[model samples]
Target: MKSSDKRKKRLPKPLLSDMEEIEMDVLSLEEKISYISESLFNTDDLKIRELTFNNKKMVILFIDSVIDNRNLQLNVIKPIIEKSAGDIQNVVNSNNVKETVYLDEALCAMVDGHCLLLMEDSDVLTYICIPKVMRDRSEPINEKVIRGSHQSFTENITENIHLIRERISTPMLTVKYSSLGKTSKTKYAVVYLSHLTNPEIVKTIEERISYINVDSVQSPGYFEEFLEDSSFSPFPQYINTERPDRVAGNLMEGRVALVMEGSPTVLLLPVTFFSFFQSTEDYNNRSLIGSFIRFIRLISFIATLCLPAFYIAVISYNYEIIPVEIIFSIKSSLEYVPFPPLIEAAIMQFTLELLREAAVRLPNPVAQTIGVVGGLVIGTAVVEANLVSNTMLIVVAITAISSFVIPSNEMSTSVRILGFPLMILAALFGVFGIVIGLMFLLIHMVNLKSLGHNYLYPLAPLDLNALKDTFVRLPIWLMKERTKDLKPQYMWKMTNPRGWKKNEESK
Candidate 1:
């Protein structure tokens, strides 16, 4: 038999199923094209257009729903057929064009909206970049701020990078792209400032991303789970945000951000427990006002986590802690409640959570209606029915509102969920149980790490300098250096804006 015939005979019979193991050199053009078609077997939108180029057979493959047809017609087909360009490199007008001899690599490129060009009797396949459809950038729907850039990230990774680049146009900004998911081949970018960011942190993040071996990474949340220090913890180790300005701000602080394709949420790493409480609005407002609001958010954090438990302790075992008049008022309200304080608080809190979830899944107008109607109707019904006490309702309502004040939704939800365990503790051992639960929580947080950095920085290790910006938003000029916990290469953000005073004294 001829050598060519022997090579064709060696090719795998189940081409699509065994394509990963099949060598590109052993397959003929006919077999390769057949394999491509069979691999995308059930996809009806897969388009394979065969045409003549330089009087030779050529084929282009792409998904009809994703590729820009205009570019394919004008830039690709027009140049190849009319200009008689011999190679795809000379014809296609794409920013990214690559030749791949591996079927797996070619398949990935084609799936990511790249047009694949295959020529007769050629072992190489060329991939032409054709941009996919993406939503326009708009103001963040969830992470809105009173003052800051209105732009948020979109589903497109390139567009998100463009938004970041527009803000930080320096050469120090570095973006590295990688593909995750063996089957899905989801693309993501790791961005950081080369000079300002710690090299070891960048290396650690890159290494962790490289080690993420999974069948699919659907979103930044999925990726974060794989990289997180503790999977079982309810608290989020990384801060996830939709606002580009937030990501940019974090990046400027020597932190790294993970931007995934097809996901609007970006993950900011090496974040602290206090970081979730801080908002872009804090910087937008004046120092005194910002500090006041920051203090309120911190107070809300404690209230969300401990308020229900504290109430359970007070009403069940420590009623003496209440003032004389307050005790009478509470006693009067609880006289009608048939259940124990624990059960009453649990019932009210669960109802609040149900209403919250329902409102989120409904339309805006309908959601608003549900929030107002659900609160009034449920609160009144429960209290009148003696299913819960008025005091319990107020406690649950206050806890819910406090949780909502947290800037990070993930942290807020975690805080709300945490109340359940604390309530259980408070019921079992009263105030003592609450104190023990809190101590355990504090220990866990101190031990937790975000990207190998402490999760409760400045507070756990006790860095007084960093503490200046943690609970309170000090004046920007006072914060002359970045957080030392992050170990940034360059710590000083500013020298002194009021340097004229020092010069005057010297003269």
Candidate 2:
């Protein structure tokens, strides 16, 4: 048998992912091309060009889909062909060029827009590639803010990193690249403040991402399910936001952010339950106004979860607790309805949800029309038909508005879903059932862990120092240290810059 034939016979029959090694000396140029072609399942877009220069045979291989043809010709082929007698590294003008003996690395590089260079009678293959950077500066549709930076994260990972880097220009700001999903081979980056973040926390998050053994990862949602400590908890363990300013703020507070390619939403981990209620607008406004807004949001959280249930409890079993006139009004509204309070509330709640969903799935202008027209027409028609009571409609409308007050959409949805069980409880045993449900909720939150940190941190564990910024937004100068629960490398974030105030008073 010929030497080339023997090398071909030794090639593995496994998939491309499993074929990690390729001995450059054992495989001739033709055999290497054939091996890669077969490993890639003989895809149609794979381009293989064979050229000869200085009496040496060479093959330039890359997928036509991802690589830029102009770059490959001008930076790689033109240089190599123009100067055929020297090392390819010094000759090629590509920004990121590397040489490796492993076929797996070459395959991955090709998928990521890098072209592979193969030569006969050599034990090393060269890589010629240019980084692709895309810029998108549109404001986020969901996380819009009135003050502060208007820029949001983009689908491109490089641009997302640039957004955060410009905000936090420090040597300690570190970003590490990784690949996930066996088939998709999607790229992701782990960003954190190396000096502020706990080393163990960073290591744990990276390991969890690496251990995700799946065929494909579509979004950060997939990773969240695998990374969260309590999968079934009602509260969100991570905050997903598209605003780069928000991400920069969290990183400054010693949190790790996961930025996935092709996704504008970045995942921030080890978050507290209170984190969902906080927003970038809070920091932009005056301290007192920000604190008041946060207070209202917290009240809304409670109202969203317990308002309907409270109404159900009062009408079903605790009517004596209400004023006589209000009770008469509520009682009269219920008289025309055939179902009980719980049933009446459920109908309106489901109807409101349908409207909300319709409004979301439709276009912006159409969604607004549907939301207003559909809600008013349906609400008025249901009340007039005696299918639902006016009192129940009012309660449901308030509940929906309260749910929308939540800054994080994930937490808002969870809070809305939680209301159903509470309503059911109120129907079963009235006020006692609501109390029991709330007790269980408190228990679950107390026990839940977000990447091993207390989900209710600074509240359940009672950290007095961290509380300076938890329930309320204090003046920026007042928060002298990072949250103690995170155990950040640098506990003191700042000293008293306002110490000069005392000198002014003395003068």
Candidate 3:
């Protein structure tokens, strides 16, 4: 059998080191091309070929789909195929090849999705670029916008990076790629503005990522384990966003962004509680409308947790607080109910949660059907069955809706889980139990720190200046300070762009 045919029979070694010895054994250019082609063919869609120029033979190889076909046809294949001699001068000018003996420099062209052509006696390789397959369009699940770009991120990491780069074309934007997951070998990149981001924070993040030893790092969330200060805490240390605008805004604010392979979400480091509540929609709309919606979100948060417990405690134990007419109406509502206050409330909460879980798991059309039917049937049947008081049912329904008001799903889940403890305490010790539980929760929040920054910043640490942007996002111009409570050494951000503006005449 021919050497080329024999080489094609064997599989390519997975490691780069194995290829070096094999390359030496394959004396002929055809044998080398055959070996490389055979090795990587099954794993990747590789294009391989052998070219003859005068007496010298050159082998060319590349991942076919990854490179731009036009560039390869016009710049590489045509030049080599049309050449008539071993005259290095003619090949160099005709092919636009910069080097005749540097293999590493020639291979650098492959990083841009190009293929390389290697010759006998010549160290240089010809690089042919081509295009790659792309995933079909899918609506963005995380960064949904009613107005603005409809294009969402894909599972492909390169495609996601392309989407980001297309938006921010600034020269200062930088991307540093790294690998995690010892076995999975998942690729991820740290993107930030070199001039805008803090050097200390970047160094800290890079150092932390380098030490990560895991089975696999598939998503941005998986990388969080290395970056986060407190894992056991309920709060998320990194802000996961899908919107390029939000990532760009955060990058401009001295924060670094992480994009991992297969994960559509971008992770922003050193995030705050105030940031978790913010949605891109808030900024997309008018400032007045945005502030109004934010205020409602804050109100809903307070209501979702404490409202149901307060209602139960007030009606069952603190009847004196209710007016005579209101007390009579409440008593009448519970008259037909057979279950006690606590049991009735539990039944309602449990039923609502079950319905919610079912709706989420089912198909959208079916989920909507289930929601409508479940609400009508359960609400009427429970009341008619004398299972729960009408007033308590209304309170439970309102509380459930309020929980959804939280912008972050993690925060919403935390709020729901935390509610049960408050509800149990309210049932056992009237209003006093609620107060004690709340006091404990307050202490936990105050003590909680995400990435060494207080979770309840400006509220617990008492940074009065930070408050203007915390509970309320003061107008851009009025905000004149940085959130440097983390004692960040590089405390320079264009926080108040207009503050330092000199008079027009001074310019």
Write down the lDDT of every candidate, Cα atoms only: 0.81, 0.82, 0.68
lDDT of 3 by residue, 413-449 (tens): 7787787888888888879888998999889888877
Q: Which stretches of candidate 1 lie over 4 Å from their true place?
A: 1-135, 502-507
Better of 2 and 3 by lDDT: 2
Best by lDDT: 2
Sliding window of 10 residues with minimal summed lDDT for model 3: 8-17
lDDT of 2 by residue, 1-507 (tens): 233432212233222223333444466677778877765555444689887655789889976645667778889888878888677778788657787766656766665667898887764778877533334488888877788788888887767776776676433466677889999999888888776788889989978877789998889998899999988887889999999999999998899999999998999988999999899999999999999999999999999999999999999998899899999998888888999999998888898889889888999999999999999999999999998999889989999999888889999999999999999999999999999999999999999999999999889899898887777889989988889888898787676658776547554
Ranking by TM-score: 2, 1, 3
The residue pairs in collision within model 1 are: none
Q: Which is the better candidate, 1 or 3, if ranked by lDDT?
A: 1
lDDT of 1 at 433: 95
lDDT per residue as tens, model 1, 245-339: 88888988899988899998899998999999899999999999999999999999999999999999998898788899999999999897789
Q: Which sections of candidate 3 miss by over 4 Å? A: 1-137, 480-482, 486-507
Which candidate leads in TM-score?
2
Instruction: Give the RMSD in angstroms, all C-alphas superposed, for model 3.
Output: 11.7
TM-score of each: 0.74, 0.75, 0.71
Ranking by lDDT: 2, 1, 3
Candidate 1 vs candidate 2: the TM-score winner is 2
lDDT of 1 at 377: 96
